[model samples]
Target chain A: MTNYHGQWLKLSPVAIIYFAVQFVKDVGNNLIYLLPAILVGYNQFSENGLVIISGLSALLLFVAISALLKFYFYQYRLTDGRVQIHSGVFQKNHIDLPFERIQNVRFEQPIFYRPTNHICMLLDTAGSSKLEAKIIALPKGVAESLKQEILSHKTEQVSNAENEQPEAEHEQILNSRSVQDLIIHGLASNRIWIVLGALAPFFNSLSEKFIAGIENLGVDVDALMASSQYAFWQYVLFFLSIAFIVIAFMALISVLGSVITFYDFKLTRSNDRYIRRNGFFTRHEVVMKLSRLQMIVYQQNWLDRVLQRVNLKFEQLGASLDRQSAGTSGGKIMVPSVTQGEANDLAADAWPENKLSAINYHPVSKRLAVRNTLIAFWLLIPLSGVLAYFGNGELAVASITLFILSTAFIILSWKRWGYAIDDNFIYLRKGLIGVNYRCFPIHKVQQTKLSQSWFMRRFKLCSVKLVLACGGQTLPFIKRTTGEKYIDTCLYQVEALRKSWM
Target chain B: MLADKFSNQSIKPDSLAKVSAQQFTPLSRAYVKVNLMCRLVFWLIVVSVLLVLYWQPWFPLPKMVALYLPQLQLAAGLFGLLSSTYGVIADKNKGYAIRQHDFSYRSGVIFKSVVSQPILRIQHVELKHGPVDRHFGLANLEIYSAGGSMHTFAIPGLPEEKARELRSYVLTHSDIAEND
Candidate 1:
């Protein structure tokens, strides 16, 4: 049994690990500059390595002292239905977060703290730009109890006469990802471009080494370059082999990244919330409540379609900031590499009253296709003219190829643009390469905008934009009458519904 | 091809006509004067800075630039003066309407748009007063929602007292239900 101290208590001594990790990160950041200087002046060091030894010792001493000070100063307490935190060395910052305002309470256990039974706690608030409160290191038992206490307090405050329904009483395992699913997810996601971009700096050295290796093999590379009658079939075979090797390397890196990140992804539903646990080295646990969900997006790219898989993202209120910092797949609850049927099941479970099959999507005005194609042609005229003026036949061919691609893209985008509205929900479908199907509850709209530009006005067309708690979605180039009617219906629904959006 | 599942009988084009027919209360007429004064002051500062830079004896005046410096200054001043004047006149068309459950604001001269936000969705309200606005006895009332790049609504050039009353009314009436 643990001693029951007063409300305000210092974190466990195991918190030193947290501070030490932070200190190492800071040193690593500074080492970018310091390491070069030390290496450049390596000749000045003594034969016994006296200077290096002293410098290393001083860095360790600094990290230890700072970690100790930080651990000593940080203090947190639960009082008056709020989490009160006091910290800072010189400025002494204080934060008071009410239980009702807390959006999520996440518990994370680093690999280093596995034996010590300590974990990190983070609290996210509704509208704040950053975490409302964070406890770097606390005992696992204490963290769990604190989470339960805060959640109970929040339920008590929210369960007024209007919302007296019992929260999620039945917990169920919704879905889990397997290693094969993760591999498929990695193949579907196009992260190879990102890895290739990161390797740009080493490309010159790699090519030089490749050339030297070929020379050592006694290959006449310069003679081949100068030869006009080179065998086309041989060249094609060589290029195909090189492409195969590069693609294989990229596929390996992508699979490794996906495996390490989502080693054991599990999703569970408890009461009114969906909890997702993923990641291997740094575990991520995201909790999203049904009442706080703003929108659901079903996305499938060309590769995803080929694999018969879809990615579903559940966006909750105030998740946009996190999404901006951590891509679309981050912050939000994303179920990746799932079959279309499983995705439909999840969406049906989330919104049982709304039938996804009942959506009747209305395509946008065909004039949008004409407008886009005209713009593409106008852009191509200048590009093709410049290429022809430079007397570059190959570039001229490339420009014509680009023109064809743009035309195809415009047609695809036109075919994809559509919107649907039922009594209780709105569905928007869009995209060219990757189709995005967004469904949102009607009452969750915070604001509605109907806009028309000069060209749109002339064409008797307008656009409607809906701003929800998470983010905004726009349906452009719809008939003016249709846009206006949809806007009015949305406004009416928002005013009629008494249910809470958050 | 698969979009024929749902019915579209509930929505009628006439509903849009009715919504547009609803009258909106115009902003205070004195707002035009306040806007004009602010614009004039901003343009005055910009012109004065340009004049001072040109007047510096140590500053090199290139032969090509010196040839058209006066005309350039005159064109800039005229452009600023005309645009500010037009902006004030355009402010006259701005209007807002407060309904039982929602409020709407209409703005813009060339690309007009009307945005509406339900009262229940309002997260908070604020009254901001700038030094120039204070001198003119005017304030701007800003209403914010849970998440958006811009404020839900920001109505500028309201009387300071009126802005305060509206802020309090919104605060008192916006049912403070638990969110998130």
Candidate 2:
């Protein structure tokens, strides 16, 4: 690719659509206030539709004008060593991101814009600030060529310093999930709960809508309620019906959401980077360098265990603080619904020095179960007494059930909690119903802390927390001696390793 | 699975000499005086405000509270002064150990804890001085990592000159390009 250096270029005209979409999103977010204003205006001037229409048109015009102004101001240029972006309507922001500092480059193309051959390119840097440089709606060819140019420069620099030849650009498909696999993943994941929780706020409005629709059909709700002096069994049946409908709705949404987000999910490795492409309406191409990966987490819920599947997530250096940016593939790479063997193979490919097969995890102290059970018992006893005092037999039964289940979980977690440290990597296994096996190079650890609580001090036990660039993980209820040794060894490795953590 | 061939080595806790054996440098003794002065001023202001509220007619006071307000204020002031004095003494015990490869900070009055971070992992260093600290000619040094709630480590009450020197040393030694 030839260099088009120092040319200040505007985004493709199709970026107008992106800006328009952003405008619509902003309007949607302000709907919480806008809806009430419209309602109040309607109440004030009962049948004045024109007033409401004019107000809405005014709002739309404001959004469109602002979006256009933003599009007019945004410009980017590719210089010799850095990509410079000039944006912000009022603040006049300028950002210069060197190619070497770029941790990952991602390309996204919405299905509607595919015919125009336009793509959104995002560049991430390993910094505390969550600012990402994004170029929206660039011609697909231009985006691809520019990405290649920057990446080639980065690879050239790395290879020149290391005095080694760059690897051939041969893409290898590590794993691809089938429709069946997606369905299993959807079932195994907790998306249904999340969707249900999100919908909780709108439940009252949904029910109101339903009742209004019934009333519009001329049903006498009051009379029906008065007539139905339901028996115990009939009430149970009615409640069960509502629950079944809600569960079925949530399940459908969860399945559709997962399928849409992860359709044609494919993981491929090219040189020292792993590229993932997925999603249906909006295609995402995420690139993750092997060196930038901080940890590999193998997670398995009870459903996943039953299905003999695991979800592997590769966390990178920095966390995406903004919830909006989380939608884009930046901070972490997830491979959903893969077999254990495939997960191991991928981990090995990513970090060959760490022998996952040879890991011998030492379990945490057994007394952890006793301590946890005692704490649970103490808390649950009072909770159960309160429920009994309230004369709520159903809630009392539920609380007892929860107490028993938690006791079992505590025991199971105590049995599963373990850690293993080899010369190169540290592996930590923890969970109850869902087990997570997290492993990272010892050298990547930023900090280590050995803490002893009053209870742990009594038992001559301590917990060790390993802080990474992304976050910290704890191995609890270990003998103080072992915890200190692990911390010391990890510290030594972190200091001795010459390679950068990122 | 090679779980059977794993050799588990157990070392005595006391035998681990890395952080324990390293001598730590305590904060400037004047820091205690600074803390004491700040605490006293803060408590004095709080007590004065409370006394004004009790005596002033702007706010309606309950009859019972008005009856014993002066006594209550006296007891509260005494308690505040004593606790602040104790707190200053306790903070004096806080110390930091800077090793060749890492730095450890030990703090706490009742439950002591030692947190160590590899020098290579430090993202940035900051020296901050508040009004009270400026009055005392002291500054606080904060070290942060790439991600977390707040600073990975903070050492309060260092002489301003020493703080600046340490900050420069950290900035010079930290290799940002290696991480990039």
Candidate 3:
């Protein structure tokens, strides 16, 4: 008797590649164990070569049987309230997952999967590591129907009287972004990473030119530079030209990578979940619950600030789940880059009542500026002494220029740091090059901590950090008395809101 | 995650009073040795720094010591003060309340924060025991609250049986109630 009473299971086009990959991996893994035995047998009985032949035959038989079993036996079914999977040959194996136990379900259709009309579904649960169950190369329509069935089952399970209108089941499939939006956002973020990428080539070219110049010092070309002191400047010009060329090459690579990564990026809304789809080759699909969002952070780099574009990140519950080796995978989920206006619109969509404004605030007074100058002065003290000892006026000037520029940047950043709180939410903004504004409901905060250092305590200054499920929000520096009062008010409101909020 | 708020008579002062003071795992004598060694090492560094600054006659020791003396003294005094205050706060906040709908633990000195979370809101509960805590017959109960930034409401020094009872009660009443 079969558990999942369904027709003969059809393998997804994705299954072909997945099965092939797995087969190769299994063969490779077993080879490590089998290779030594075959080699040893071959050496031991060169005369009686039957041993090696038989051993090879046995290994091939083992690989073939296992691969065939794995590919042929696995079966899945989408029932009314649960997903049933069955596999195994000698001893049958069966597993059923009820919809209620599932935390989230999302589907990804890479370029390859898109052509085949096959989608991979990832089921997340309340476990340390994700991937409780996966149905690879599932039929797209069947997958959607399965998702709807699960959602309907989930809606039926919510016992709350207030939300018992069967309203949760009526999810909206959000509108996708236009190509214009994607191109604009892509261009806005392109320049900075371009400059960063180009820095390596720029430095490499300069170093190479320096080495070349030293190499030419003993050759016929040495006379050109020796006779004409102007040749030193010419050497510098040649190095600068090479640096420019390298910078251009890096800039081109950065632009191309940015375009590919964010090409045709689209964010769609589906009632409780925000669906984000992006990537060129290995397309990614992320589904995030609106209620589960811990905090929404709007960030703008120096270039982005100038461009009036803000990148949005929705920090949600759960640890870093993406197995891909990317740094920005966890902590926050990006909404496929947006302009400041679009970002505000997204925020409004997520939280209709908490409409963010364009108001800005100032941080600390000239003390921040004084601190910046002090850092510069400290660096200059050592630098000027070294320069004076070495009698290098050029080095001294360069050091002074660097010191002044850095100090100015820090002072500007400090001055720009501030926060705004309104209604039942708080917006904390900070940073220089990477400015971010993180907003969340005050009621969501689980813990409000106010810390004071000895210096801060003396000066009546403190730092307030509000801990949320996703992460913590910190007001790094604020007046101690104000900080304490602010924390107390927020805490009282949080408790009161907790009692009344439902 | 805004939890489902419910009112029930399960939460009461009587529930706490029924819990015995004898249930607490008494602080072991090993703490005295560890605490003393830490204090001794700390003071040794302080005394050495002070001596190097003020007592050394070969260099401009007095000036440097004078500059740093207040900061060092303040740091030492504050450490002693905060630790003592923490102990008092811990004592005051020691105890657990099991309400019909939720459980909470309140602690800390300067920041008196209480993690009042509903049993329904708890995604999971973890029971951990350190070697010292185990030796003292104590267990640490960490309750992970969902819908908020993953803040684990932890209570240290709960009797092993009480921890188990609370864990069982929370587990039985949580979202998984239908699973069984």
Candidate 4:
């Protein structure tokens, strides 16, 4: 073996944008805050030359500070057996990671780091239980070689005596969904809201300008307002038209955005890991291992349930990316969309023998649903009456329409809420728009609670919630008497189980 | 079979040496002190709001006082007497035991919770001593599990020496690496 020492660098297009955006944001924020001071100091400037010198000095200082920070706190080294990082100027923190414990590794070069050939290496390890994410600006080939070395088989394992098991048969080298699947997923999604978002500004501007132009004309404003206020047909036509146009525009934008973002969405399986590569302009690569998965969630909304499709998300092993990663969908490895049977089959493939049971759960009956619908109707009646009065009965149609819609909503809400239990798993299927079939292993359930609210108690209904090590799942609005009995039995069984988990 | 035993053997070393039954000596007059503080704070807020709202020179003090007198007394009584009992009961119901092989805790009054952890799986053992607990010659033992966010479990009111011994015993007995 030779000691290969070289300066390595590579970056993605995303890195370039990220760096430029961050730099611009930092400068803009400071400049905005310092505007008053800068203006006040303007009078003290003797000449243009002095001002220019001062600006140049300040710019040089800023660049020097940034570069110094980068130089001092950005150390990375890849040895034969492990990766080493000694960073931070003040405290000098060090991280030593062995190759054997490394579960999954990924190379990302955001557009900002692209020009410098700097790549970010996110390493997931079995121990330390940390993501072990770091940025290593290395040559493309060297970065790839380091990843390969960590992933490569070793002769040392052969002599270890305990490493005699043959390689996994189902350890896939590469697997991905077709472009057709992505297209279907995007089309089926409820993304019509984006077009509305795009059109909102235009509509707002138009309305403001129209109102201003009318005011400028100086006609009898009060009489015109009174005429329109009493005109029932005009009011109905005007509001409805606006609503229809906005919804249509939103639908168009949402459809276009989805198509471009997930154009070639793909997920590949390699050895002990799964890699998800998606997004056209800003490509994102997420790598995760099988063992790190605490649980696999298959969910569907009402739309998905009716369409017989489910979404898969994996609960990974660690501190869960903190709050900042919430915008990135909580860092969960989502397998986008699949049919109900396909979702089950995929879970089975991931965890071979485990499958969900079909022990039908009794949901909150039609009686409760009707009661809820009546409550909603009564609550909205007063508001609707007030609106109807204000608009001279033009709004009466709106209230009647809402009352009619509530009937459908009440039935849908009740129908979507259900759960199933098996010897090894608990499955909760709920939601109206994007249905979710959440399954958790019985052994993984940390605790269970059966709660009754005043409204639910009156209707003889209760909610049962199960807490797990990774996350929580709830089966809401179950018949109180039956729900209590079911919870008691489950608790007893859980207590009796020989193995202990908490 | 040999490999299982080998791994298991490496995990549990001198298990009996670390096993102990601890009888926690409950906090004494600290309960009364806390109760008094709570009552004082509660009354302060109530009186301040009343004074601010009804600060009129024309109105007689007795009349204004009589209006809020019953509610104020009820709040004060509830704070003074009921809170200490709640705290005592909460403390009494929580107990845990640790051995070289494993640790188990029994908690909660209605919905009981019991957590048990094997020594080999523990990522690290922390001995924390706060000012209040230090004055009472008490230390809390925390055990962190691997790859889980809610991994840390704390058992309070252990003697400092015992906490140190437990930490050392676990370190020596468990084969798991302390990476974090």
Segments of candidate 3 deviating more than 4 angstroms: A1-10, A19-80, A84-96, A159-184, A190-241, A319-333, A359-406, A499-502, B1-125, B137-180
lDDT of 3 by residue, A108-216 (tens): 6656677768887766554433225667678788777777776666766674534656654344543344555555555556565544654564566556666677776
iRMS (Å) per candidate: 5.4, 5.8, 9.3, 11.9
Candidate 1 lDDT, tens digit per residue, A1-502? 1243337789888888789888898779777567646654666765658768998899899889988988899998777677788987777889888888888887667778778888888887765544457888878888878887778777876576457865655668898999999999888888888857766866786688789889899987898777778788888888999999989888888887887777798888998889888887767677777888889888898889899898888888755555465222344788878898888888988998665545778999998888898898888867888998999878887888898899999999999998998778999999898888899998888888878777788999988888888888898899888888877777766654456687
Output the lDDT of residue A107, model 2.
90
Candidate 2, A1-502: lDDT as tens digits:
3456789988877787788787787668778556646544656766777987898799878878877888999999888878899987998888899987887799988886799988999987765344568888788888888898889888898789888888778899999999888888887887778656766876787778788889899996776566767666886787899999987777777778789989999999988889999998999999988888999999999889999999999988655354225454444789998998998898888998876656889999988899898888888877888989999878888888888999998999998898998777999898888889989998888888777777788888988888887678788889987887888877766665545686
Error of 4 at B142 (Å): 3.7
Top candidate, metric TM-score: 2
Give me the candidate number with maximum lDDT: 2
> What's the alpha carbon RMSD for model 4?
9.0
Q: Please tell me which model should have the higher DockQ, number 2 or number 4.
A: 2
For DockQ, candidate 3 versus 4, the one ahead is 4
| Per-candidate DockQ vs. reference | 0.38, 0.34, 0.10, 0.10
Over 4 Å off in model 1, which ranges?
A: A1-5, A26-60, A158-170, A195-224, A227-233, A322-331, A377-404, B1-19, B40-55, B67-71, B149-151, B174-180
Clashing pairs in 2: none
Per-residue lDDT value at B136 in model 4: 59
